[model samples]
Target chain A: MEVALETNAVFVGIEYLAIFVWGLSGGLSAVRKRYDLFSILTCAWMTALGGGLVRDTLLGDLPPVGITDKGYILTCLASGLVVAVAHPEIMRLKWTMVAIDALGLGLFAVNGTAKALAFGSSGMTAVFLGMATALAGGLFRDLMVGEVPMIIRDKHLYAVPSLIGCILTVIVYKIVRAGTVGMQWEMALDVVIVAVVFVLRMVSVACNLTFPGAVDRGGGASS
Target chain B: MEVALETNAVFVGIEYLAIFVWGLSGGLSAVRKRYDLFSILTCAWMTALGGGLVRDTLLGDLPPVGITDKGYILTCLASGLVVAVAHPEIMRLKWTMVAIDALGLGLFAVNGTAKALAFGSSGMTAVFLGMATALAGGLFRDLMVGEVPMIIRDKHLYAVPSLIGCILTVIVYKIVRAGTVGMQWEMALDVVIVAVVFVLRMVSVACNLTFPGAVDRGGGASS
Candidate 1:
């Protein structure tokens, strides 16, 4: 029972950290656009909570924790406030922000999949839910500011790492659930998967890796 | 019980019609952007179902009808296909499309509020949910195309009528639920509210009505 409690606490802590980092990313986006404080906060809350909200809704989890938990809301607001007041300072830490954001992506991917599986979702559905939970926050922030979602447009590895992490998480979860492994093993594997995903994201960014764009249809084709 | 069944049928029909019309609007937007067939369908589905999905999630109505109901999906797909194959014809009927879209807004507004109330949401929350149900589809479509949502930027009325309709729906729903009026009366009043909202939207469009823009802070002030 104590082990279970510790596990829950650890996951909750990760969730809060992810929300704060994502909120900061959201605030930076709004500040870059020269929006007011209210809009900045709006972006922060939406970017931090939107993905989880969608995942929970899809998985039949009502009254999602993002809205119900005071900590989540306060953390999001604080992140937004920090960015609004000191954007230049935040901007100076560009690489640090990117690393934190990548870590948040991995955290969200694992957390979302675990929750979805706990809710009795199929492995396939849970993987998609996890990816959505990792990606939808940034998607919301971009959409609010009338920009094409960078997940699709940018030549960077965002969705790929999350997808890989989610798939691995689902595999490990199933293996553990089937009694092939202990709870501790599953937890350890989850951490490893998240770390690998983070590392993969960082490498992709460093190398500027990208998927091929649209195929040539011969109408002013760039390809 | 027979009356209740008939009322459900009526609302179901309205919901399907609203989905179809909104899907067409989405498809039109995609076509105007010269998007491919898949993207047109995506836009249609998002615009037709996005609002209801958000509303249902917020109201704790899990496994939202937009995903579970085959009729809704089929209607949205059919609308998209119709627009894709005959966009010129669809564009030629601009006024007809506008009228249908306005009527759809009213239908969605009433339907969303009714569902939220059924799910035990507060009256105030239901009003916002209803407005979201009416407006979120277009917001999704606009965002997909990287355009500012017309609900915020357009000169013509959109949200106002939806807001009025939702407020009226919530008031009438509460009044009827309090046992002061019958279900039939509530249904009748709902139709009246929808009609009023439709008329209000059309009048606003005809008159080119607009709300005041953001307060000018003298930074290249247009006001």
Candidate 2:
């Protein structure tokens, strides 16, 4: 029982850290849009919470953790507050934000996969859900700000990396279940997978990788 | 058999129109962000398809129509093409975009409710799904662009209006089934509900009657 509690604690802690980083990125983005402080905080909170909300709702949960848990909301609020207070200094260190954002992505990808598996979702569904959970928040942030989501178009490998990490996590879980490894080994596997994805994403951005040219098919598309 | 075919045609036609308008808004928004044409098209497609994708996936459907249907993809592509060509001129007439957006919202709200019912969802869940379908695309667009989602922070009554329209549609369907109303009356009810929502949205926008004020539960209060 204690072990289970500890595991839950570890996962929740990592999730909150990821949420903070995502909130920071969202706050900084809103600053670029010249939104007032209220709007900035609102955007930050939404970016931090939106993905988890969608995941939980789809999984038949209510009042998603991001909204129900004081800790999650507080973490986002604190992140936004700190960024708002230190905007000038933080804005100057663009690389710091990017690094944190990448780390958050890695953490979220792993966390989402683990969570889905814990909920008894199949491997394929777990992987897809993980990728969705990691990317959805950023997608929401971009849309709210009236910008195109980088994940869908840019070949910077954001979603791809998340997918890779999630697949690795699932494989590790299966192998460990076969008695080939232990809990510590599983943790190591997760770390390595996340690290690989983080490094790959950084390199992709550095190399300015992008999607291929467009094919124009004509007409008015509506949702 | 002819009646069923006619129903299918009407539903498909309205669905395509809804996708077109939603996609157009997304494409135009991407253009405003100065994204490349490929990125614009991607955003357009996501905005057009995102809500339906969510709705279908939650309903346990496979290979969502937005992904599997060539017609849907073509519609998105066409919307992007038109937006790319006409954006400069259209940028000046924000009201036109707003009107079309409202129309799309209403149509999708009704369509989403109908689809949810067809999928055997409960009335409450159907209404929720309907509002989600109507608003999710725009919400996704705003988030992708790093803007505050209009549904959350803006006082435009966007989601609320959709909810009302959806409920009205559901009630009409129920009445028709109870023999208190005919099929034509049910269809007319849908049109009336949509029109009411659309007009309400336009009036709200023009009057600038946004949500009253910020609720300060925690964090620093905004001015």
Candidate 3:
């Protein structure tokens, strides 16, 4: 029981860090669009918190944390402010942002799965929620900025990486329960899943791997 | 009991019509964007069905009807095809589209309230749901196109008109239940509410009415 509680706390910390990275990316993107400061902050907030808000509302939770918790809002605001002020330097740190975003994706996948399980969702539902948590924020940001969602269209393993991470997390949880592994081991297993997702995403991007095309140019059917 | 069922059926019909109008608007917008036929159809479908999808998911309903119902998708597709083939000439009838949109808003607000009440939601929640149903589709469209959500930033009475219509619908339902009005009169009440909402929105637009400004233009405050 103590071990489970400790694992939960670690999960919460990862979730917060993921939110911060996502918020920063969204803020920078809004700035690129020449939006006013208020619009930039709005985009940051939505990108950081929108997925969780959708998840909570769909689960019939009241007053979603994104709307009710001052901490979450403050985190978004602070991240946005930092990015806005450090825009020149941050623009040169593309690889760093990509690395952090990969980490954010892995952590969010685990957090989403755990939260869905906590809410008593079935395995399929939990997997969907995990994917939603990891990808929906980026999707929202892309849609808000009039770009095709990377998960939906880009030639990279974005959604696949998140999906793999979620599947790994769920599998690990089930295996640990079946094998009677300790709570510390479960946390370690989660870390391994995150590493797998991060590495897979990086390798896929390097190799230019992509999902089968869904739509072809020139109005022809592809898939 | 017969009267109650009839009233519910009328509300449902009005809701469907509202959906059709919103769907048409979405279809027209997609055509204007010069998206290929499939992309136009997808955008139109999302615009028409996105609001109700959000509402139902928030209420814990699964696989929102917009995804599951063949008729809904068909309607959106047909609307898109019509607008796409009609070309730029269709854009000339701006007043027609605006009038239809206003009527759709009123119908959607009333339907949202009725649905919420049927689901046993509190009165305040019902009202919010009504406004959400009326505005969410347009919000999704704007967000997808990388524009500030007109409902959130514009000073127009867009959402306010829906709010009034929803409140009036709920009040009428309550009064009718208390036997203060006959069944025929209760039906008339819904029509009156819709008319009032349509007029209110048109007047507000014509008069350039807007909400009080909340954010300062100058960079005085931190993000």
Put the candidates in lDDT order, highest first. Answer: 1, 2, 3
Candidate 3 C-alpha lDDT tens digits along A1-223: 2223225666667667777888988877777765555446656877998877777775667545565566777889887777666665666777877887888888878777767766777777888988888888888787766778767787888899899988887877777767878656878888888888888888887788877765668675643
> What lDDT score goes with residue B155 in model 3?
56
lDDT of 1 by residue, B76-115 (tens): 9999999999999988998887888898899888888777
Tens-digit per-residue lDDT, B1-223, candidate 2: 1211126566568668768878888887777666556667767987998887777766765435555567887899898887877765555667877887788788888888888887788889888888878877877777766678867878677877788888987887788878986766766677788799898888888997665666777768853
Candidate 2 residues lying further than 4 Å off, grouped into runs, are A1-15, A152-155, A177-184, A213-223, B1-115, B118-223
- Candidate scoring better on DockQ of 1 and 2: 1
Model 1, runs deviating above 4 Å: A1-6, A36-38, A62-71, A207-223, B1-53, B57-117, B121-131, B141-146, B151-223
Q: Which ten residues in a row have the lowest lDDT in candidate 1 chain B?
A: B214-223
Best by lDDT: 1
Per-residue lDDT for A82-137 in model 2, tens only? 77888788788877667767777777777777777777766765675677678878
Choose the strongest candidate by DockQ: 1
After TM-score superposition, the amount by which residue A1's alpha carbon in candidate 1 deviates from its true location, in angstroms, is 14
TM-score of 3: 0.58
